[model samples]
Target: MTEVTEAGVSKAGVDEAKAAMREIFPETPLQMNEHLSRRYGADIWLKREDLSPVRSYKIRGAFNFFRKAIAAGAKDRTFVCASAGNHAQGFAFVCRHFEVPGVVFMPVTTPQQKIDKTRMFGGKFITIRLIGDIFDQCYAAARKHVEETGGMMVPPFDDRDIIEGQATVAAEIVDQLPEGVIPDLVILPVGGGGLSSGTTGYLKDVVAPENFIFTEPEGAPSLKKSLLAGEPITLAKLDNFVDGAAVARIGDLNFAALKTFSADQVMLMPENAICVTITEMLNVEGVVLEPAGALSITVLEALGREKLAGKTVVCVVSGGNFDFERLPDVKERAMRYAGVKKYFILRLPQRPGALRDFLNLLGPDDDIARFEYLKKSARNFGSILIGIETANPENFAGLVERFETAGLGYEDITENEILANLVI
Candidate 1:
């Protein structure tokens, strides 16, 4: 198999994408962000692909795939795809736009919000099948359906046309920049690498940045692992917290363009740490971002102060299809990462004034967020789950010291998922 390099992502393909895309939606806005510029000490611009029709860049690739397939005289009028999230919504929207019949298979565990959005986009042009509890199962079912019914299977991120289509974003970035405005760095969030590969390849051909920083959720660092091993490797398990970017493996087609970049360029950020960025953007900047959307922002702290100062940087805020129902979980993770809250399992004495004694040990700034008695293991002591939130992070250390000095037997369950998910 011949390898495709960054140079191989042709400008002709991007031009074709631009021509084809205008039939669907106009180019997304690329605007300079004032808030981020002051915070990062750089001229920061956001290529607002999140403002796309499907609230993501996913639609661009999906639309391009179907258009090219139809032009190639793919006689199968029906298209089949498996995705529970953005891709499904993208595929649905494009299928409706083209008046092509589509069957989208999604995991049974997919949220109703996603399902409804996909339906709303596709309207009469698509039929949805809730097949399996997991994406692998749904993907398998969709492939089987394609084989049996002669429908074309539109993969989410692993195709040449998809890569070409996504590259249009890079073209827009280049075209939209002010005169003599060249980015020092471009930070991209990688899932299967369609967007990253496309953007990087196109920019390298036109106006390559001084550096590229590819970020992935630590729970799903497919690109980092692939670059390290010199081949794509499937993860044994994936934390679906960053569901939009939690891919098990980088797509082979996407990795082809991305292969030239050194593994050192890729950064892996913790999933919980990303929530802190998400919450901060929502509350402070009023920019509501999904977990995957906040990937570039979360890596800034680890990038050191000097690397980011006085440089023009572009951070791709990938998608904004956040489900508000998960806000509590996001808040909890943010609080924990910020060191504002902690959970402890305490063996409080069963005697009178015991609770009052423990309460007095807390600093004036510390407030109890959760308290529950497990059971009286003995007549003298009882196991209690205690959660404390403090105004200042330093207060937690002081509070812990007071507990130790008071001879209270306690275990911090904040970082223990087995105990936390069960009790807290």
Candidate 2:
């Protein structure tokens, strides 16, 4: 392996990388958020990585990788990478900026919006291949392509150069802080562990590792699982809804960079809970966030105001490449997580007043979101698939209590994962 010093990847090298990034874009804003501060009773700041040219800090790593690689005499190298979302755009943006030829391998399941944005960023400088259903499979395709074509692989988060590039985010954060305002806690969202590892590695001296909380999608807790296992581990299944941070396995290099931290430092954030934060930020603050971008912020509630009281916390709002088309689904998930929405199968009587009786059971705050009959399963018994939206979540308890008291049999399908996916 080429030494990182030769690749410009030391602590001072990260500072140099940040300075070099000015050619592509200026420093992303580090703004103190009064709304979150008041809500959590703590001083909360946002490292707005979402405001970058690619709408993510991934650009930093990509730019640094290319800069160091080309500078170390690989100027004519053809680069390739595999990514589900944010990293693709970053690699594309850097490729275009350098006028370098490159190819991006993306999962077939990646959002169309992300694919389009990546093409828009790379322009004529890059080619995109939709290779597999998941990032890991896509990554394998990318690697195989690299070996066949003899092209340099610009790994998304698995190389020393990549980590060094990502470490520039830490440099920017420290530089952008207000005078005498040291952060008490920092929350980072982990996908393949590049950002968390790089940032923590660079801040090893300044920020105590215990003060950092690394977050992962609850459905894909690779970092936490790896920490417990003492080595990198691949997840058998991964939920791609949080596409930006949904890696099946944490990068070996990135995991090595983060191995010092205990498994307890990793927090698994529920995918639905992240949706709650996304909807809340969009509705209350007009800040759009993809599920992965909302990961750091969503964990704030889990930490509670008590843990955050009087402390200075920095949340990295990592990316904003959210597809508006997914907004309805996101809102639905959010509402369900907030307990203001539910789906159930009501045993409605087929008699004339039977429907009216069931309707009468609902409180004034409840509204029917969906009312559908799923065929007659038995004599005079049709499965009434009903979705309810209410002002207060508690109203459903009353509705369910009434149903049981009246000898009406029903099933709450909201928490039934299989039924929720198949029918709801």
Go through the candidates in order and give each one's C-alpha lDDT.
0.88, 0.88
The clash tally of candidate 1 reads 0
- C-alpha TM-scores of all predictions: 0.96, 0.96
Model 2 lDDT tens row, 1-424: 5224322356877888889999999999988888899999998999888899989889988998999899898778789998868888999999999999999999898778788999999999999999888666898999999999889999888887788888888888899888888889989999988888888877777788799999999889999999999999999988888988988899887887888888998999888999999998988889988788899999899999999999999899889989899999999999999999999887766667888888888899999999998877677766799999999989988999999888887999898999899998
> Candidate 2: lDDT over CA atoms?
0.88
User: Which sections of candidate 1 miss by over 4 Å?
Assistant: 1-8, 206-210
Q: Which ten residues in a row have the lowest lDDT in candidate 1?
A: 1-10
Q: What is the lDDT of residue 193 in candidate 1?
A: 90
RMSD of 1: 2.1
